[model samples]
Each structure stands twice: as structure tokens, then as C-alpha cells.
Target: MPTETEREESWLTRDELEDVRGRVPMLYVIAVPVRVGEAGDLDQVGLLLRASDTGRMERELVAGRVLYHERIRDALVRHLEKDLGPMALPRIPVSPQPLTVAEFFPTPGVTPYHDPRQHAVALVFAVPVHGDCAPQQDALELAWLTPSEAASTDVEAEMAGGHAVLLRQVLAHLGQTL
Candidate 1:
């Protein structure tokens, strides 16, 4: 186990992160928490309403950067707890194969996803959560929508940073097409 000091040291400083972003695409893990029915059918999708860096409120998924020396599953758990509170018991799959890989470019139209801050390559997963969920961190609220509702244009328009696109991909992966 790493000490707290060592863990802190593993994270990049603001300047260092900026420099690194300019030089290479940052790797990220994006977990889409879902509720499955008794038969293992997709029930609802979880989304977080939070204030972005620009101070605008937007809907987003459970996502965060993979820290140095951290496993992708660890990052997913960390981020899920960060936004969804500690009670959100996420069942991470044994396989790390993502439902899809989303490449977010700094420039728009380069891909389905766009991140103006940096080029981010995200491994996306649909994690089934089986515990109480309370919005935490910067999250203002948590919304659970059915697959059809999640795929609606109105909901997509409310999402930022290409999270809506990622959500749609998750829906498709579950055999629930818009």
C-alpha cells in the first residue's frame, strides 16, 4: 500500500498536468453506473448534474483520470465514490474490456467526443451499482433515467464534454438503441 504522501506525489501538479496534456493524450476511465432489473436487463442510467470549470451546470458521467501506478478499476472505484457517495457499491467487471473507447479531442468535429482542455482517451464501462447513491463532491443532484429517456435529444443537449455521446454508446452496448 502507498502512503498518503506517496499517493499525493503520484498526482500531477496543475502545471505538470498542463505540460503533459500538451505532449500526450491523457488516459481516463469513465464509468457509467446503471441499475439492472432482476433478469439482468438495463433499468436506468445514472447521471450527475454538476458545475463545470466554466461555472455552467451540466450533466456528466462518473469519470476521472487514471492516476500514475493506479489500476483502471481502482480509478473507476475512486471516481464513482467521489461523485456518487461512499454507499454506491459498484460491481466492477473482471475483464477490463470497455464497452467502447471514446477519444476526445481538443478540437471539435475531430471525433464524437470533444474535450477542450486536453486530448483524452477514455475506457468506458457500464457498471451496475447496488447501493444507496447520494450526490457528492461538486454534484448538485443525481438523475436516473430509462434508456430511452437517456437517449433523448433533450437530455443529450443538457450534457457537456461529450458525456451524452458516451451515454448513448452505453445504451447501445446494452442492446437498447435510441
Candidate 2:
């Protein structure tokens, strides 16, 4: 059997991934990072600021693809650490479950989510982090906001690709919808 590293090394190249993505709905993991109060109440949600492919800055949740043979929980941890620094310390359960499943279509209006590059099915999770988070990789900054603030029109306008809708779903799942 191949080691995990070896298996990861066998992943498709960028062009191959794009070709396959066009032919099928790709699976993805989306995370909404949260900070909890002493009572374990969700105090704030974390969103990343990044410049999109279109050259405009946008707000987004921690999200990425689940590699071949990778477990769902492992994917969550990997993306969280990749986007939110290694010290984010996400609290993934032993058997993690998603808050909801979101489907992003290439065409808009099919669903609230839209990804023009490809159709993607995302398992959305609400993850709590106990340590400090410094935005990493393509993320310019990590902004922690209250649920109401996150639901505001200003923040909503800054988010694209259905991230604003994802925020509402996550907050509703946590019983903190604005």
C-alpha cells in the first residue's frame, strides 16, 4: 500500500483537475471558523479577505478540496490550517459532521451558490478554534465578526460566490442567525 504522502503525490495536475471538474461535480469542504466564549457560545465568526481571480477583494470562509482518500475531518483540518495559519487549532470532532450540504452550480439561479469554474458540492461545517489565527496562504487577513455584523449588507456586499449565503446557513445552524 502506498503511504499517505505517496498517495497525495499522485493527485491530478491542475489541467487534469480542471478537465475532471468540468465533467463532474467536485466535492469540497467548507468551514466557518468560530471563536467560542467561556460558556462555549459562539462569540465570533472568522472570514478571510482575499483578492479573487477577477482582481477584486472578497470575503470567504475556509474552504478547499478533499484530496483523494482523505477523510472529511482531515480535509477540514487541512483547509483550516492552510487558510488560518497552523496555530488556528480547529476543534474537529472524532467523527465530524457537516452543518449542511451546499451545491454550487456553474449557472446562477440553480442554487444560491455559484462557481463558474465548475459545479461543486460542498459539505459545510462550523468549526471552533481555540488559538490565535493569522491569515495564511492567499488569505490577506482574518476578520472576526459578530453574527449580526456578518449578516449586514456591507459585509454581504463584500462576499461573492455564495459565501454570504453560507454565513447565513452557518449562523442559523448555530442558532445565531441575524
Tens digits of per-residue lDDT for model 2, 24-98: 989999999998899878899999999999899999989999988889999999999999989999999999989
**Candidate 1 Cα deviation (angstroms), residue 121:** 0.5
Best candidate, lDDT-wise? 2
Residue by residue across 73-153, what tens digits does model 1's lDDT show? 889999999999999999996656788999999999998799988999999999999999999988999999999988899
TM match of model 2 to true structure: 0.94
Q: Stretches of candidate 1 above 4 Å error?
A: 1-9
Among all windows of 10 consecutive residues in model 1, the one with the lowest summed lDDT is 3-12
lDDT of 2 at 98: 90
For candidate 1, the TM-score is 0.92
lDDT of 1: 0.90
lDDT of each: 0.90, 0.92
Give Cα distance to truth, residue 10, candidate 2, Å.
Answer: 1.1
